[model samples]
Every structure is written in C-alpha cells, then in structure tokens.
Target: MSVSLMDFHADWCGPCKTQDPILDELKNDWGDRFDLEKVNVDEEQDVANEYQVRSLPTLIVENDDGVVERFVGVTQREDIEDALERAGA
Candidate 1:
C-alpha cells in the first residue's frame, strides 16, 4: 500500500531547519513506499491550517485512507519508522 506524507514547515523557523535533515533521511529511505510532500506554512497556509498544525515541524502521515498519524514537533527518525510500520508500510 501507498501513503501520503505531508510535512508542514516554514523557512524562517529554526525547528524546521533542524528537522529538515531528518525528513530528508526519511524520504530517501521511504520514498518508494510513500508520496512525500513538503508544504510551507507561509505559502500553504490553507493546508497547514486545515491540518491544525500549530508548530513549525509538523508531520502528517496519511493516505487516501485518511491520516494514520499526526506528529507535532521534531520527531525522532525511529519514531517515524514506527509510525510507517503502524500504518502498514
């Protein structure tokens, strides 16, 4: 099965910068299993607000099946793997 990974971040946010590498690692490792999209809060406020992301580095792992998990803050890479596994990736 396939999943949708949405990352909400802003350019000026420090946490967003810190989380970028982690997300890059995740993408390189899991790209084949999921469709990853990065949405900037500044440019994609509609999407960000819809997801109720109050933080800079928010991650939403969803599918056409709907969101399986919503993570707020700088998530650990292993935790992300766990979420993917729980989502049946």
Candidate 2:
C-alpha cells in the first residue's frame, strides 16, 4: 500500500511556503516511496473541509488502512518521515 501525504495549503500562507520546500525535498529524496499531494485550499475547498483542515500547512499522512497522522502548521521533516514509517510506506 502506498502512503500519501496530503498537504493542505493556500498561496497566501507564509507558513505553507516554509513547509513546501521541506516536503519537496522529501518527495525528491524518497522518490515513489510515497505520494505527495498538494491541495490548494482556495481551489479545493471541499477537500479541505472534508479533511477538516483548519490550519495552513496541515499534513495528513494516510495509507490503505486509514489516516496515520494529521499535523497542523509547519512540521519537521523527521516527524513526517516517522509518520510515513508508521503507515508502512
């Protein structure tokens, strides 16, 4: 089962800017180990609401089983990797 990282962010969010690069680096480094999906809250309001994303840079880590972790605000790369590991990515 592939792990997915759903990044809920908006263009005007400063913290999301900071979080983007970290997730990009991980996506480059990991390469096919997991799926990284960026959800622009402005454009994807329904998806954001479904996930109950109330903050910028919310990282939702999930796999076939279900959601493994949900993090709000800027998150550390290590923490995200830990969540991926937990999801058996």
Candidate 3:
C-alpha cells in the first residue's frame, strides 16, 4: 500500500507558488514513504477535471484505500503532514 500526494497547480497561480516549496520539502523529507505528483493544470486539464479541481493548489492525499483528504488554496504544512499521517505515509 502506497500513499500519494497529488498537487494540482498552474504556472500563473500565486498561491500555488506558496504551496510548492512546502510540498517539495515534504517530498524530500519523506522520501519513498510517499509519492508526490505535480499536475500542471494548463497541460493536464483532463486530470484536473477528473479530480474536479476548480482552483489552484488543490492537494489530494490518497493511499491504496483511496482518497484521504482534498485541500484547496494555500494549505499549511501541518495540515498536509496530518493528512499524510492519516493516510499512513
């Protein structure tokens, strides 16, 4: 069972900029314990639509069991870490 963090963002989004580094740090710190998938909404519209992401910086946390949480806007590191913990990352 593996956990994944799907980050839906665009190049022109300001809040997404704030969200990126936090996710990057988590990806580096957690290593193989979790997977981080960065989705560029401008390029991957289908993926963004499939997730029904209407805004920038949508973070979807999922595991083998399925989605654990979905966050929009500039999410805090603690909240994301908590979701990862719940997803058994």
Candidate 4:
C-alpha cells in the first residue's frame, strides 16, 4: 500500500506554520514510509480545490485506494501516525 500525506496550507496561515514543524519531524522519523507533499494553497489552488479544502492546515492521508483520513486545523503527530498505520504504511 502506498501512502501519501498532502499538507494544504498557505504562507500567511499561522496554524499552517505551526503544523509544518510537526510534519517535518514526521518526515524525518518516518523516512520513506510515506510520501509528504506540501501544497501551497495560494500557488496550488487547483489542487486544494480538488481536495475541497475549506481551510488552512488541511492534511490528507491517502493510499493507493485514495484518501484514508482528512484532518483540519492543527493535528498531533500520533494521530497522523495512526492514519499512516491504517493506510498500511
């Protein structure tokens, strides 16, 4: 199962900044277990719209089967890890 984490955020979002470090840490720890892609809402509005993102700091965990989990606002590391686990990463 291939898993990917899409972080939808903008440069002006404070919560999105707060979310960044957590994602970076996860990337360091998890390594290649999952793919992490940061989508700037301002630059990648189409992708954000495709995901139906209504807010900043939206995290979508998807496997080959598609989206497995969606998180809005600031999220904890453990929660993300759980989602990755569920996605079979």
Candidate 5:
C-alpha cells in the first residue's frame, strides 16, 4: 500500500510554522515508509484549491485507496502518526 502525506501550509502562517518541525521529524523517522510533501498554500493556491484547504495548516493523509484522513490547524505528531498508520504507511 502506497501512502502520501500532504502538508498544506503558508509561509506567513504561525501555526503552519509550528507544524513544520513535527513533520520534519516524522519524515526523518519514517524514512521511505511514506512520502511527504509540503505545499505552501500562498505559492501553490491551485494545489490548495484542489485539496479544498481552508486552514493554514492542513494535513492530508492519502493511500492507494484515496484520502483517508484530513486535519486542520496545528495537528499533533501522534495524531499524524495515527493517521499515517491508518493510511497503511
């Protein structure tokens, strides 16, 4: 099962900044277990729109089956890990 984590954020968003380190740590620890992509909403409005992102820090967990989980605002590391696990990562 393929899993992808999309982090939708903006450079100027404070909450988004807070979420960055957690994601980086996860990326490092998870290694090749899952794919991670950080999408800056300010620069990638189209991508944000496609995902229907309405919050500064939106996390989308997707698997081969499609989107499995979506989170808005500052999400915790545990919560993300749980979502990723559920997505078969």
Candidate 6:
C-alpha cells in the first residue's frame, strides 16, 4: 500500500497557507494512491511536538507499517510523486 501523506501546517504560516491549493490539486490527481491528512500545528500542538514537527508545511510519508520519509516546506508535485513511488504507491 502507499504511504499516507501527513501534512503538518499552521494557518498563520505563510508557506503552509500557500500549500492548501497544491495539496487539493494533488489529492485530485493522485486519487487513492495517496492519502493526505492535514494537521494544524497550532491547533494541535501535542501532535506537532509528538511528531517532532519543527517547521511549517511538513510532509510525513508513512506506510502501513511506519514512516518512510519526512519532507519540510511546500513540496513540488514531481518531488511528491517520486516520494510516493519510493514508498511503493
């Protein structure tokens, strides 16, 4: 199975704000191949701290067993697609 994409973000963060549309587009394109879960770091401080999320727009790719990779910032489509492939999407 493909790894789920966990998106850590905060509404107050500029880059995170910019990532919303991109994520929406990706969800539509990738379909069931990738699962995207958006988490608001500010609203969910415990999750942020637990996940060790130190930056905005953090993308954590976790497979059925565990995490495969972690990406920080607004990720590009190509990069994300590559990551998905690596995660065995």
C-alpha root-mean-square deviation, each candidate:
1.2, 0.5, 0.7, 0.5, 0.7, 1.3
Give each model's whole-structure lDDT: 0.85, 0.95, 0.94, 0.96, 0.93, 0.85
Cα lDDT tens digits, model 6, 1-89, are: 75698899886889987878888898898889888888988788998898899988899888887878888998887787787888887
CA displacement after TM-score superposition, residue 1 of candidate 3 (Å): 1.2
Ranking by TM-score: 4, 2, 3, 5, 1, 6
| Per-residue lDDT over 10-54 for candidate 1, one digit per residue giving the tens place of the 0 to 100 score | 889898888889988888987788777899999989988898989
lDDT of 3 by residue, 12-87 (tens): 9999999988998988888999999999999999999999999888999999999999999999989999999999
List, residue by residue over 13-33, the lDDT tens digit for candidate 4: 999999999999999999999
Worst 10 residues of 5 by lDDT: 9-18
TM-score of each: 0.91, 0.98, 0.96, 0.98, 0.96, 0.89
Which of candidates 2 and 5 reaches a greater TM-score?
Answer: 2
Error of 3 at 82 (Å): 0.6
Q: In model 6, what is the error at residue 31, expressed in angstroms?
A: 0.9
Tens-digit lDDT track for model 2 on 1-89? 98999999999999999999999999999999999999999999999999999989899999998899999999999999999999988
CA displacement after TM-score superposition, residue 33 of candidate 1 (Å)? 0.7
TM-score, candidate 2, is: 0.98
lDDT against true structure, model 2: 0.95
Weakest 10 consecutive residues, lDDT, candidate 1? 80-89
Order the numbered candidates by lDDT, best leading: 4, 2, 3, 5, 1, 6
Assess the local accuracy of residue 19 in candidate 6 as a C-alpha lDDT between 0 and 100: 77
Clashes by residue pair, model 3: none
The 10 consecutive residues of candidate 3 with the worst lDDT sum are 21-30
